[model samples]
Target: MGKKRLKHRSLFLLGGQPGSGKTSLRSAIAEETQGNVIVIDNDTFKQQHPNFDELVKLYEKDVVKHITPYSNRMTEALINRLSDQGYNLVIEGTGRTTDVPIQTATMLQSKGYETKMYVMAVPKIESYLGTIERYETMYADDPMTARATSKQAHDIVVKNLPTNLETLHKTGLFSDIRLYDRKGTKLYSSIETPAISPKPTLERELNRKVLGKEIQPTLQRIEGKMVQNQHQGTPEFQAIHQKLESLQLPPPPSSNTPKIPGL
Candidate 1:
C-alpha cells in the first residue's frame, strides 16, 4: 500500500516585537507564496481606518485613541472569519507573551489546519531604536508623534519579548517552528517528529499571568470604550462586522472548546 499523504491548509504566525521586521517578512512570504496567503496584520486595520491619515496629520493623539481599540477587534474578527473560510493565513503581531499566538495556532489546528510559527529574535534595544528610525522615516511629516509612538512600543517590547520567545518554543502548538534573526536569516527550526506532549501546567500558568497582567486590563479598557463610542462607526469595524455577519458565526461554544483569545 502507498503511504497516505496528509494535506491541510496552512496558517503562518509571524511573531515579533514592533519594528522587529514582521511586516517585511510577511510581505516576503506572501510573495513567495504567490499571493495565496491572506494576511491578518494588526496594522492593516489601523491603516484602513477612515480618518487614519487625517488624524495622523491633525491630532496624532486621537489617532491612537480611536484606532487602537477598533483595529484590535477588527483583526480578531477577521482572523476568525477568514480561518473559517479555509483561507491560508499569514498573521503578523507582537506576540508579546506567546499566549496569543499559541492560542491562535491551537484554534486553527483544532479546525484541521497546519500551523507554523516564525519568531523574530531581534535585540530589544535594537528593535526599539529601529522602530524610532523606521517610523521617523515613514512618517517624516509627524516626527514628534512617530517618536512618541515608537517609544511607547519600545517599552512594551522590552518588557515582554524575552519571555515571549521562550514561551513560544515551549508551547508545541505549531507543527513547525523557526527562529529568525532581524535580517530574516533563519536561526533554528524544530525537528519534524511525532506528536509531542504538551506542558499544559506551564502554558496555563503563562496564560494566567499574561491575561491577568496584560490582556485583560487592555481588553477591559477597550471593551468599556467600545460600548461607549460603538467603535465610532469606523469603516474598519463595519467591514469586519459585515464579513462576520456574512459568515453567520454561531454563538459561543462551551468552556472546554478552544477559541482564540482577544489580544
Candidate 2:
C-alpha cells in the first residue's frame, strides 16, 4: 500500500483558555476538512493513559501538573511525525504563551505548510465559569473520567492573553488570524493573502482595554445568575464572584485632571 498524499498541506492552530471550546472548534475544522487534517491535542493523549483516571482522582487540582510532561512529549513527537508525512494538521493550545505555537508554525511553514491561527476571544469571566460548568457536567456524567481545570491555570492564561495576542500578530507567521466568541461568532480577522478586492483589511485591537468593555454585559448577567441561584454565598461561587468583580471596568479619568505639557 502507498502512503496517502495531501493535496495541500496546512497547519491550523485553534487556541483559547482552558474552557473556551477549543476542542469543539478543532473537531469542526477536522470534520469540515475530513480527509487529511489530523488533531494533535495534549489532552487527548493525556486522557488516553491507562492510569489517567486514577491520577486525576489522586491529585485532583494537581493532576495536570503531574501528567502534562508526558502528554507534551507525546504531542510533540506526534506533531513531528505527522508533519514529516505531509499531513494537514490542527492543534489546540491554551495560547497562554507564544513559544509553542510560534515554534510549531515556524517549523511547519518551513515544511511547505500554510499556517493559520484561530483565537477563541471569550471573555475571561465566561471562560472561568465555563471551566466550572464543564467540570461539574462531566463529573455528573462520569466521576472517574472527569477532569477539572485549575483556577490558577485558567487565571494565568487570562492574564497573559493580551500580551500573547500582540506577540502573535507582530510575529506575522500566520496567513490568517481570526477571533471568535464563545458562540462561534466571528469577532475579527486579518486575512493577508490572495486578497479580496472589495473588502478592506479589517483589524481589531484585541487587548485588555477593548475586551474589558466587551465582557461587561456577560459579567453582569453571570453575577445576576449567581445571586438568583443563591450561590453567591458558597465558597466557590464567592471566589468566582470576586474574580468577576475585579474584572469590572475602571472609572474614566476626570476632565478636571491636569494634563502634562510638552513645553
Candidate 3:
C-alpha cells in the first residue's frame, strides 16, 4: 500500500476597510467552521500593545510611517509560523494595497493550502459612517479619538478599494473570490460571475479621497462639536488631513499589467 497522504487545510483571506464588517463575518465563519479556523487580524497585534488606545490615536495621523510597519511585521511572522504548522487560517486585513495579501496568499498556496479571498463591498461613505458609529458607541469616552481613527479608515477605503478589487481579479491567486456588502449579502462571486469594474459611485468616492475632500464635512462637524466644548482638535489630525488633500495618487494600473513580483 502507498504511504498515506495528509490533506492540507484552507486559507481564507478576508479583506475589507476598517469598518466594513470583516470582524463580524470572521466570527460567523469561525463559528460555522466549528473553531477549526485561526484568525490573524492586524489590529489584534495593535491591541496587544499596552497603549492600544493611544496607538489608535497615533494611527490616525502617522499610520503608514509609524504604525503599519510594526503591525505588518508581526502579522507576517504569525502567518508564516501558523502556515508551517498546517493550521487553517482566516487572515483578515484592510487590503489597502495588493502587495501584502497577494504575497501572503502566494506563500500559503506554495505550502499546499487552498486559498480563498473575500472583500467587503460596502460603499465608502457607509463604511466611514460605520466606523464613526462603531467607535462612538464602543469608545464613548473618547469621541475625538473615534473621529480621528474613523477618518483615517475612511481615507484608506476610498483610496484602495477599486485597485484592491482589480488586483484580486488579476492575480487569480485564490480558488474562489467573493464580495459581500455590509449586510452580509453576497453581491458578487468569481465562481458565479464575470469580472466587472467597480460601481460608478465607488469611482466617485475614490476621486473624492484623492482630492482630499470626502471627509471634510465630517471632520468639520466633529471639530465644531469639540471647539464648542472648548476642546481643540489635535494638530496631527489637521496636518494629516491637509497632507492627504494636497497629495495626488497615480491612476490605477491596467488589469492587463503583470502581477506584482514576489506575489
Q: Please tell me which predicted candidate would have the highest TM-score against the true structure.
A: 2
| Candidate 3 residue spans exceeding 4 A from truth | 1-6, 50-68, 141-147, 150-153, 194-263
| Alpha-carbon local distance difference test for all models | 0.59, 0.67, 0.62
Prediction-by-prediction clash tally: 0, 0, 0
> Per-residue alpha-carbon lDDT of model 1 for 42-118, expressed as tens digits?
77677677767877777764566667787899988988887787778888867666768878988989878888876
TM-score list, all predictions: 0.61, 0.69, 0.63
Candidates sorted by TM-score, descending order? 2, 3, 1
Cα lDDT for residue 154, model 2?
88
Candidate numbers sorted by lDDT from highest down? 2, 3, 1
TM-score of 2: 0.69
Model 3 lDDT on a 0 to 1 scale: 0.62
Model 1 spans > 4 angstroms off: 1-7, 31-35, 51-59, 141-152, 192-263
Candidate 3 residue lDDT tens string, 1-263: 12122366888888777666787667546654666788887765654555656766766534434555677788888888888888888888777788877888889999998888777766565466456445544334654333335466567665777777676777778877776665666666677755654333335433333223544565455444444444435443344334333344543443333321111
Instruction: Please give the distance, in angstroms, between residue 14's alpha carbon in candidate 3 and its true position after superposition.
Output: 1.6
By lDDT, the best candidate is: 2
